[model samples]
Target: MKRVVFAVPGSLDTPTGGYAYDRRIVAELRQLGWDVECLNVGEGFPSPDKATQSAARSLLLKVPDGQPIVVDGLALGVLPDVAGEVASRHPLLGLVHHPLALEWGLSAERADALHRSEQAALALAREVVVTSPATAKLVASDYGVPAERITVARPGSDPAPRSSGSRNEVPHLLSVGAVVPRKGFEVLVAALATLVELPWRLTIVGDLTRDPNEAARLQASISQHKLTGRIAALGAVPSKRLAGLYDEADLFVLASHFEGYGMAYAEALSHGLPVIGTTAGAIPDTVPQEAGLLVAPGDAGELAGALRRVIADAELRRRLSDAASAAARTLPTWQQSAAIFATALEKLA
Candidate 1:
């Protein structure tokens, strides 16, 4: 049987965009008749300590000789030494969601180290698969990977029932992402505070435990803005619950610092909810002007203005919502993505 090993970081069940993409791709690959073996190298990756690094190296080394091995970029980017050794012996492919060096809040030295390491590791890959065209371009320009060897299989979105906007006086806003600095939930809060006169409630759905300190800080910010009563920080919920939130939302917004592929924005469009986000990274590619409003990243005033325009103008919101639903129909499916990924893997042979 045709087979391949997919080595990923721990917490395969995590309710994050990258993890979700991994899970869906793996399932579709198996259904397509490829024996996909998932190898869970230890977690705490992209910043793993010595012990974790050792454990990950050992696990990766155990794969049979000459077998095709695909490593998640979260793990692959930090292990250049191991990648060089393995790629010499096996058909190694690196699956990158985004470059780790682009993450927010990294020290200059650390970012440079990560960039150098990732560039070296990706250099050894037979080819690289990225989640979006933006990332493919980054891998080529920033990571020194050849553009020809990169394949872009944008994350797929499942069709969803159109959102039934809150049939009430107050509109409900939803934002989904990990409660981390990079996700920029704090920026969203700050922007929302400026529009206190508008009757809108914001609900942020994400893994609060991923960064407890950030969660605490966000809570404090809410209290400081006296928006504790208007904003609800519902930590990560199951897929069903998230769909329910989507159905209840009038608009979707996330002021992320950057995104390789903004899966949440796509999901919102699938649910027929108009989007309001920053034009950071792949966001503009994921969300267009017809479906939503986009502003400069970290600009609280701009975000507030965009939100006000959407909230106060029901006709405009309705038009954007219809456009979102139309765009959703054109999104790639998991099946199509899997077919492209399978073809990319076939090239490794």
Candidate 2:
């Protein structure tokens, strides 16, 4: 039987985009009859200390010989020394959702350190699997990975019911992502503050606990903007509950600093909710122009203008919604993504 070890940084249940991608891909691969073993090499990844790094390396070293080992980017990028060792023993495939150094809120020195380490780690891999073409390009051009060695298997979006829209007299805006600096929820809050006179409410759904300080900071920002009364913050929610939120939203927006594939934008399109997001990373690749409006990252005034236009013009909303439904039909399914991923894995044989 064909089998591979998928070594992830932490629990498979982490409710972020990267983990969600890992979970779905693993399930699809198993459904396709691959013997996929998920090895949790311990936590505190993308920033593991000496003891944790030693322990993680030990766990990875214990994988049986001859099995292809697929390591999540979060763990793989920070473990160059271990990756070199792993490459000596097994076929090492690095799965990168995005390069770690580009993440928001990192200091210049820290980002540079992560960049150097990730480039070194990726160099030793037999294959690199990225979730988007943008990442594939970045890895090849910036990380020095050969273009031929990379595969782009973007996250799959499940078909969802078109949003029935808000029951309220005001439009309901929805944004989904962890309450981290990268998601730019603070930017969203600042943008929304200028549109209060325009009848609209924003609901943000993401993991608040992932970064408590960032979450608390967002709360303070919301309070500062006097938008606590207009905005709803729901920490991590179950998939079903999220689906329900999608069903009720009039528009979807996320002012993310960067994204590998912007799964939330893909999901919003799938729900036939017109999108408003920043033009950072792979967002433009994810949200079709006809289906959404995009603004410069961190530009609150630009974002506010886009939001106001979308909120005030019902005809524009209808047009974008129709286009969004069209775009949704073009999204790949988990089954198709799994098939592609399987083919990528087969090439390693």
Compare the candidates by lDDT and give the number of the best one.
2
Q: Candidate 1: list runs displaced more than 4 Å.
A: none
Once fitted onto the true fold, the runs of candidate 2 whose alpha carbons sit more than 4 angstroms away are none
Candidates' C-alpha lDDT: 0.92, 0.93
lDDT of 2 at 324: 96
- Scanning candidate 2 in windows of ten residues, the lowest lDDT window is 340-349
Q: How accurate is candidate 1 locally (lDDT)?
A: 0.92
Candidate 2: pairs in clash: none
User: In candidate 2, what are the lDDT values of residues 1-349, reduced to their tens digit?
Assistant: 7899999999999999999999999999999999999999888989888988999989888988878999999999999999999999999999999999999999999999999999999999999999988899899999999998999999998978899999677999999999999999989999899888999988999999988999999999999999988998999999889999999999999999999999999999988999999999999888889999999999999999999999998889989999999999998999999898888888777
Give the alpha carbon lDDT tens digit for every residue of 173-201 in model 1. 99999998888888888988899999999
Task: Note the clash tally of each candidate.
Answer: 0, 0
Worst 10 residues of 1 by lDDT: 7-16
